[model samples]
Target: MSLDFKPGAFSDFFRDETFRESFTYRNSPDAIRRFPFPFDRDEYMYSVNMEPHVPGRKGSVFEKTFDVDEHYVSEMIDRAKVLADDPLRCQSLPHMTLAGWDTLELIMEAKARDYPQWFSLTKEGDRWHWINRPLGIDHTFTFLDESTLPYGPFEYIMRQTQGDWTLQDERDGTLWLDAGVATSQADWSADFDIGMNFHEWHAPVPLAHDLGVFDRALKFLLKLQHGSPVRRFNWTMTVNPLLDTSPENYPKWGPTKTTLTQENLGRKQHLRVELQSLYRLPRSNAIAFDIRCYLGSFEQIVTVPKWGRRLHRIVRDLHPDLATYKGFIRNRPAMAEWLSKYDDGAPTSPGWWPED
Candidate 1:
């Protein structure tokens, strides 16, 4: 497919592919301190699928490397261990989903020229804030001429990609929500694909709720939780990348940050099952769930665990009376039971009143 990048979009100057490759090939260099990151050789790759949100927008395949060192590997594992131990850390939400965590494989691949120390640094916002500094990596990429060498080399270019996610509960075997998004970004850009999610828990004690958090939690549980695990997920794929102003030649596709292209079809899903901690000690230390989604929206939050049953509130796209699925959330049940109950036709009403 023809890329929409404008002239000079891929001018060379990105990083040290030649030098780094030569060093690694000749002496086996182990690590490099790239600003904004410290990567090992293993992390480097030719392609990357977003670990968090949407599918298809998996970003253009890379023919380059992301070299991460053992130190970086240790850090990533250490972080994953902590997130796994805390049930709330895995909650599926925007801020919590893999943001600030993993380097988006394709979305934001800013590398330092040589090392983090050599890059320029200048403050961008508040004093305490980390100023804008060269990530040390340049994004000038060049297209490959496959016919000449049968595998012409490729380079890294700054580009925008869209991502999203949908999470399911493992304990109750029910889908709690469906979250999605489309995004584009430049430097200071981000992409963290966290396998986040929520689970029904029966808290030994109920905690207090201010309006804001209450609304947020309710909104959290409002979507359909139809995912199983990263391995057993489902959804169609939305493969087309958005074309607007871009830094490459089409800065025109630079992303207005005002309007967004819409798509609900073609979303693919992945699911995985793993043992996780599901308790929060801060607020009463009652029962909680470790729900984390790889997409950007969902996050980890403490709530009275709703397990074994599901609420029966109806979900209406328009402004239907019930609007949300409170009854379904409240009645919370194991996924199998919920399916059985709704098998014959929806009752169309709560047990005691007309649901319509």
Candidate 2:
């Protein structure tokens, strides 16, 4: 069933939630069960592990083209605040205007078709009527007309959606990071990488270049066709469910890394997962990339027995370089120690499913 958040019936947890200052963000018991656990094995490593973005288990993150859940409204609110503080977070080059509209159409249609109760999109020729009940947005605008919308098409639709979006214009046999909105990222800067090509933007990732991971991935993406989308999972460690982990604001969140202790590690240290999807837009031929972030706390994750066992093993045996790259090396020892209490050395079943 689709979700509904009508007035007076909205849950108090969401209405009073915060992802910053006091940091009251959390997952409901149901949300934790559905958490997109990234590791399918006891160990973790980077690879071009992508698959068709087809619908999966009925209530999973992959069940829809775009997954909207309990955290949708709160995330959009957080995104608005981030953009207000730093407008550069959303950028689209001159040539990316068509790509912006392409992305807007993609998201609006997906959400309207998937969750009709909450979103509705009606098109009459070039004019379109869009209603987004969750965000209290309803407007009729002419498609491809920039003057009809408050912001550029990319920024306009992105503000109402969850996750960070990047539009890549393909040219010269490679994808260019020409446009993007990155409010909820993992130590990356959209502004800094705006004009960078595929390899140039990914140059900082350790060991992946030597492994030829990026080379193969770039080759595959260059051939992506319209109507077909692919997705993969990427994860990192974060402190306190903070979504705005961009390096530009590191000074604000950097010190929190040193604050983790045995008493609070379970609640503060979180496993941040990104469900990255790449879609080949029909009109612009630009690839629309969605980096949807999911944060599950140690306390919530350990509730699943298999998850607890596998998490401890992965953490304790992780490569030192990976730990440092993920910004959790300083707290890895404590995390493993805390998670050990939940793991009894049992051999976890072979997949990431909670039922396993």
Candidate 3:
């Protein structure tokens, strides 16, 4: 059986006055624009498209090291729901305990510095105080003490932040998936991939491994500097506004991808983009990979004429195997057709849209 999607209902969320108002930074010079639309051209191929995490680079408003967007609270709530339903969605090996602590401290410090109003961290002797104003969480605990944070260091960090993170330890000339919490995965199992080498975990990716992209990425990651982080972009299609698309919940979301048709394409299909950041923790020397998921529907994305047409072109030119790997092969044709409506060759203004 297939799930039904109502275009009117789905479009309402994107068109809501309150929801659109949440995009307060849309016109600001420093506003991190929505839709870091990854396609550079009509033909899409994978590559190690990474750059230094310098703020305001290339005239971009993503001026902060960590991104805390309007969806932070809602996404964190969804993550908590997923973790409660399946504890395995958040796991860290015993060896990664310290790495987990390092990750927690790093993110907390970043959040406190970047968003001082909502998050604050202070230390008095060996005791640390973490204040999450948004969540109404205020607690004092011994720094690095497991008992101090009942949910564990990584899980505690995951609760306050928006993105999912993974700690990678460099050893034996390879990166190991040692620890961290991943609640919003793109059809991948963090629990299953735990303890796997970088290459082993990404073995299923078609040409990236064979083309030595992963090998080169590992080398680049290992040489990454402590304070200087780098970021990259990846994208796929999702059928819902849901964030917890990990393989553990595939039984629930996998069928929705197959349910896409011309009738429901505009409402059910969403362009899911991941703003992936790589940080080298100064303390543990562990590499922290953060995945921040962003979703926009065809209706919202079409507001930006360039993004709409570019997305249509990329999907039209997408390789069959690549589309299949991304779990969208079954409905790519319908999606392409639907996207064509917005590709009327209108002169694009090359500006950002709030909804996108």
Q: What overall lDDT goes with each candidate model?
A: 0.20, 0.91, 0.73
Which regions of candidate 2 deviate over 4 angstroms? Answer: 1-16
Name the better of 1 and 3 by TM-score.
3
* lDDT string, candidate 3, 94-156, tens digits: 877788888878888878998797779998987998877666677888887888777778877
Q: Find the candidate with the highest TM-score and give its number.
A: 2
| Model 1 misplacement above 4 A | 1-9, 12-162, 166-171, 183-356
Q: TM-score, each model?
A: 0.18, 0.96, 0.86
lDDT of 2 by residue, 287-337 (tens): 999999999999999999999999999999998988999889889999999
Global CA lDDT computed for model 1: 0.20
- True lDDT of residue 278, candidate 2: 94
Clashing pairs in 3: none
User: Candidate 1, which ten residues in sequence have the lowest lDDT sum?
Assistant: 296-305
What lDDT tens digits, residue by residue, belong to model 1 across residues 1-356? Answer: 22222222212222221111121111111111111110111111111111222222111111112222222212222223322343222233443222211222121322232224322222233111111122222222221222321111111111111112222222242323322221211111111222323322211112313224333443443321322111111111011122111123223332222222222111111011111112111212112222211211000000101100111121111122111111112112221232233334332221211111
Candidate 3: list runs displaced more than 4 Å.
1-33, 57-61, 346-356
Model 2: pairs clashing at backbone N, Cα or C within 3 Å? none
